[model samples]
Target: MADLSTLARPYARAAFDYANENGAVDEWENFLFIAGAIVNDKAFRTWLENPAVTAEHKSAALVDLYDSQVAGDNDSAFKQLLGENKGSRYGNSISYPKVSPALNNFIKQLAEQERLALLPEVYEHYRHHKAVSLKQLDAYVTSAYPLTDDQRQMIQTRLAASLNASVVIHESVDPSLLAGATIKVGDKIIDDSMRGKLQQLKTQLTA
Candidate 1:
């Protein structure tokens, strides 16, 4: 099979373009994140894999799930003001009509194409596109130990400067790294760890 990212490209590009054009990129990101998570659920995945389940039914289920989650916040807010029963009833009735239409259509489009399994990939690709368009990067750093505040700041600054984009660092400690760290952003990696150096030296010696 083709790579999942390859399959996700067109849809991700389309959604990103639409969202970017409408100044709704962030909003769409939030929507995609939620939708992706829902589709990624074990229960949902099982149902999704059932050949007997119609696409329209899957689409409706996704739409309903998305709608209920949004409305749930409203339900809570209403409950705080008007008490439980009345609030929940009112909130449940109050569909995110304006928001729902766009999402409903998007989900329906995916279903029509039998491509709903692509949501998680779509979201990931969409997020990557978003980051590029916004001049932001998500960087992962694995080190031998926790990064101090100064170390974190220095890494963030250097990465931002080197990449020419705003950088957000996610740190993990892997003692096996022995020393130093590896930074990953998108498809790029900067490996400066003792483990990496040893491996490179071993490869050269073997060669």
Candidate 2:
């Protein structure tokens, strides 16, 4: 894990910088989204795992798959970069985006050395990077009590105002919450529930 973090840091930072410079954060996000999906696919994952297939073939396959997805300059650059990377390190868990030849070389060194799978952690860290740049917060709301659309909107609006960022929300019913609602915005929490209230009281009494 330490090794994976070490490998992922520079790559993630480079991608973040590129996205910021080019104002292509959304584009990069989409590309990463698609590429990650492809890499995670059973067939594609198998192909990447197979040592027999040359790196060129894998790179070609990806380029063909994403032929019209990105602009011409980006398409060529990324394809060549990833192709070389896949070839150099035939198999090992990795998650760094192939930003360019230089970065790809760095990742190849990491992969060939068999550091560890860094993709999941990289994605998590990158999400935070993106969120900060985009000024967006993702919230997961679980409620024991049902919420009306108006109520949800009010809460979201308040949260957005307080955080000074846009909000993306997902809602679910959690009977175990016992009452009120629990909202998680990034690493922050706003828990307003009977269970939470009880815990507060218990803590105060013990203290």
Candidate 3:
């Protein structure tokens, strides 16, 4: 089978193009993010994988889930059904104001194709597309400790200048690094950590 990312690319691109054209990139991003999270849930995954569950049921369940989360007082029948079944396996939590028709159609298409499991990959690719379109870059920063606000701002400033684009930093801690930080922008890594330096020295000695 092809890789999940490979399979998901077209869907992501299609969704991104649609969102961009409609000037709803952020809205679509939020929708996909939440959808991806829902699909990634253990219970939801089990439900989706169940052979007995019809595709229609799965699709309806998901749509209902989203609706319940986002629907208002002027609730649809589906929302009412979800309310009645509130104690069912899928517990309700946070919700938005509405689910757009575009999102509904997108979810329906994924359901029809039995490709809902690819949502996470689709979301990742969509994010990449969004970043490129917005002239923004996502930087992953790993350090031995949490980055202070000042440090984060400094890194973002430098990265923005270097990449010639808006930079968003996501910080992570890796205590094994001993000290310092590593910044990953796309395929490139700026490894300034002590552990990285040690590895480079070891590689040189071995060479």
> Best candidate per lDDT, number?
3
Query: Highest TM-score, which number?
Result: 3
- Writing each residue's lDDT as its tens digit, candidate 2 over 1-93 gives 356566666656776676678675654554444455566667777767777866555554554455443334443444444444334422223
Error of 1 at 137 (Å): 1.9
Score every model by TM-score: 0.78, 0.66, 0.80
Better candidate number, 1 or 3, judged by lDDT = 3
Every model's Cα RMSD, please?
A: 7.5, 9.7, 7.0
Model 1, 79-143: lDDT tens digits are: 33222322234444443332446667777899888889899899989988988888999999999
Q: Candidate 2 lDDT (Cα, whole model)?
A: 0.62
Q: Write the per-residue lDDT of candidate 3 for residues 1-207, one digit (tens) a residue.
A: 999999999999999999899888866776676678788889999888888887778777776766665465544444343444333332245244466888888888898899999998998999999889889998999999999999989999999998999988888999999999999998999999999999999999999
- Arranged by TM-score, best first: 3, 1, 2
TM-score, predicted candidate 1 vs. hidden true structure: 0.78
Q: Candidate 2: minimum summed lDDT over ten consecutive residues — where? A: 89-98
